[model samples]
Target chain A: MATGNSEVVNNAKALSIEVDKMSKLRVIHYINQFYAGIGGEEKADIKPEIREGFVGPGMALNTAFKDEAEIVATVICGDSYFNENIDEVKAEIIEMIKPYNADIFVAGPAFNAGRYGVACGAMCKEVQEVLDMPAVTAMYEENPGADMYKKFVYTVATGNSAATMRKAVPALSQLVLKLAKNEVIGTPEEDGYLARGIRKNIFEEKIGAERAVEMLVKKLKGEAFVTEYPMPAFDKVVPGKAIKDLSKARIALVTSGGVVPKGNPDRIASSSAQNYGRYDISTVHDLTSETYETAHGGYDPVYCNADSDRVLPVDILREKEKAGEIGELYKYFYTTTGNGTSVKNSLAFAREFTKELIADGVDAVILTST
Target chain B: MVKGIEESGIPVVHICTVVPISLTVGANRIVPAIAIPHPLGDPNLSKAEEYKVRKRIVDKALHALTVEVTEQTVFEN
Candidate 1:
């Protein structure tokens, strides 16, 4: 549920293409629970169904790919398909869609639903393997599906909920059209999808060997060299509606930008941390002692703290609370090391923390990132 | 960081040294500062100037709490 960078290159550069040189290929759409027009939670086991034409985003896909490919059929299933019945469901869906001459397959702009994400990842993997066809899916960067299948398919960061379906569909559809037309996708950002371990042989603007030398020189000089392919914006994130009340509400301060204690007392790894623990400071307000520290390696240490105050600015937030600028600060602030944290863990932590916040009667939050 | 917090049904005010990145990344509310590393104040500055910088950004963060916009926004002093 974290906010995402909005600096995204949404539209691809209109590269030259011979429209007549491309052939119309068939494409298939896959959908889960909600989009299948099936009920949720109450209808978790409604079984699978295959239908011709668009469901949910299929109409949008049809519009985006109208000139490039035809979506022959739309396949719908409960997310439980791959999760509960992996082998049977995969085999059945493959057999079901086998009749269509699908050039590519598209599953969710999964947003951030955990079960739906896993289902999309599994189904895309199977379709790629069994049918030997290219497939595309989109998941939020924080979705576990991204880590599991990003290397296998073009996974875009979708908004965590289906509300982003319209925004998510266009990018995925455009990618499929380009794939069908054999159009060169310049980079992940330019192309609007995740890189699927497929590297294209492109001539460097400067000669190849010279490009390498230039990069080496920049590295040696410690210049802030931007990578050739900038990380694409996970702009598919839909900012949830803002909380309506703040001044009268209980607010908590939280951060994932790895603001921890000075000496790394928790022994949390500098990157790829698996465990997150919170210290209880009910007796004292600020995390000022030497016992607390940060484990994030992405930034310089001087500002984070010799004392933990710099990273976790609970002291300032508490001060504001005492002055009535905000409602009472929650007793304990939540924290996690954000460096290279997997999307799945972040989502899980958010869900868990939300529960705690609710139970504690906290109404709003002011999160800081360093 | 702000997205997750906001999704938890809370308002988050992001304070950053590099303001553009945060705003574009869809920060609903933002407070801009002098530089990326030391967002509040440059350690090289005198105490008075540093305090001024910190206070300005902090004030912007607070201001962000009361306004609304559909797109990402950063507050400048």
Candidate 2:
């Protein structure tokens, strides 16, 4: 009877081991034509295709994954073709990957290659959305595609050249396993991924006041200590060519001071505005107290409400037009409240209106903020 | 917002009370204002005097737009 019990226990252990081996996480690898060893730039327009198993870098990935995960299939597409026919190619790739039942999708450690980086980012993003599975790729920080897609996918940071492939594969494999296993992900700094600009709340042992005081002490002592919230880096723009002849320059007025027509016709938010208003002042000469008022909520708003021109300076700009100091006013002035507004939304507002300004032959803009 | 307009190839002069904040945000051309609450004119001044202050700032901004600059520059009021 003791011998029978021992035999049953041994059989149970053997069955569990077999199950573990059979249930290894399945990964589908994606690569561009170049990485597939099909050809370089010449074959950059090849249509999407699939191979049964690991290709090129996938070999390194598979070795890194070892017993934890396996590359079930490899999908390859040309850079130019994928980008040009993104919608069609994405659907096709999704269909191809569907049969593999992949737990995670991994794309190229594209490095600084522009088209290849874009292709990798696009593929990873699509796979995550369509398959409802975790997807990851790697690219250099400065790759334009990284900026565009990092928020949507987990992009591991890679060096500028493929020479870093040795370092990249292991990191990529580790991230893939973490995702497949449904483990908690570390910060971008810890996991070597690009900062996704996501704000996640976590409990800390120390209270907020203690953390603040500790940070202050460290700052006062000139010790290097990381802040809980870091300021975003602002983009520096090189100045455009100056308007040489002001008398021939068509000027326009733009404001973030929240100076809009009275009664707030567009109903732009007093704070954190999502939209900007474009009002025509072609016939109007000045911004009178009866006609306009302040919509901004950040400031006292008393003075601005008393005289709207103090914020927008339309009265002065109109004077300049009449005095021939400027060629003409663009007729339409763009205004929005900047109070508590996100930089992203502010950029979007300017982007859409600038096109109209260019189309209207505006040469210079005088932008006001409060 | 100033950066976006400047990046679109239009010369822009930012009028703000906080010159340092404007400078840090990379405004290529800047003209300082009197104060934050009333950037263009000082409420302490009489109506006509306030107009003069507003005109001076605007005049400086006009001059700034015409002056060629390779980097960020703040025009005097």
Candidate 3:
């Protein structure tokens, strides 16, 4: 898996295999057993198979590619087998795929079928990350795999079922052609794909304030306008059960309020923190102004710098520990700056520390944010 | 971070000045704090008074951690 200088997936990769501009690009298509003309659920356990040309939906994609590209091979795997033994199947599939020296990889417009969509997403992710080549897939936005794999694959948004196969192929093929030809792809709207939550800076004709004024003018006149930045989707989780007994439960303190040692030892960003700090608080009973301070840059830091407990609440929690109101305070506290931090990075930080908390038998977490 | 820990099956109470954002982000247990700069502190009061105030808010947060909640809930006292 070698990456070229271009880090942007939409940007043309540094071509390793010679591309004779006029030659028909070789394409590899992935499909499930059902699409390979195999029996339905009974044959869902069928092993991975490679064939000479296009399969079911591939027929439509092949037509869309027309003379510009052709499906040189079709790789088919049963949904059950692929998912159950994902790693084994992925390696096997890549070995099957490598011989084709294919220009691009394309997987299902799996629609709403959960397992199939996951397989397609998983395969596309593997192809992109392992082969270091562009891969495309299509699925409904609500499909489980779409959320899991959309960031890794340039997923073409499609309707909920195969009934929309007619509309999905052209879009998928267009993106596949662009990747295969190493052409620059455009925005999700201009190109027919789902928003991958990737940001690309571009120069515009108008200045920021001018555009904002124009958009405000349109809004006042009841005209439609698109927002430059869209909020990331938030997932609602089923809350874990509350502690049965506070005195018996070990508690941990974590914060986006960014309380670190006095000198900012870890060098965490005062805003938009790319990393978090886990400081040992077991030896320290209280967060004194001389020992600890706030690193967050969003609000006035004077208060937090004076008493870091205002944000982390370490002192009161220590008092509670002495009173046996709580079993004990965790020795370490996790912290990061909340200001200007993306939801993606925040989620990543939490997921990483929760594993350690779980291992340490922490029963509950108190999170403070400014 | 609150959502992450909670989703991983550890009960978590979020202490933030922005209760609406906590609710919108699906935090199961929420505790409204004093202000943006100091979530648990009120600098206007004397040191002893501020400590008591911080203690009260923190006590509420601990209680919120112990209470059973079926959906997003704000704990304010």
**Per-candidate clashes, comma-separated:** 18, 0, 0
TM-score, per-candidate, Cα-based? 0.46, 0.52, 0.51
Lowest-sum lDDT 10-residue window in model 1 chain A:
A7-16
Q: Output DockQ, candidate 2.
A: 0.28
Interface root mean square deviation per prediction: 9.0, 9.7, 9.5
Residue range A299-348, candidate 2, lDDT tens digits:
66777878888888878878888999988988999999875566678889
For all candidates, state DockQ relative to the true structure.
0.10, 0.28, 0.30
Candidate 3 or 2, higher lDDT: 2
Task: Identify the runs in model 1 with alpha carbons over 4 angstroms from their true place.
Answer: A1-24, A197-201, A205-224, A228-370, B1-77
User: Which candidate comes out best when scored by lDDT?
Assistant: 2
Candidate 3, residue A210: CA error in Å?
1.2
Which residues of candidate 2, in runs, are more than 4 Å off? A1-21, A234-370, B1-77
Evaluated at residue A68, the lDDT of candidate 2 is: 94
TM-score of chain B of 1: 0.80
RMSD in Å for all candidates = 22.3, 20.2, 21.2
lDDT value, residue B8 of candidate 2: 88
Model 3 scores a C-alpha lDDT of: 0.85
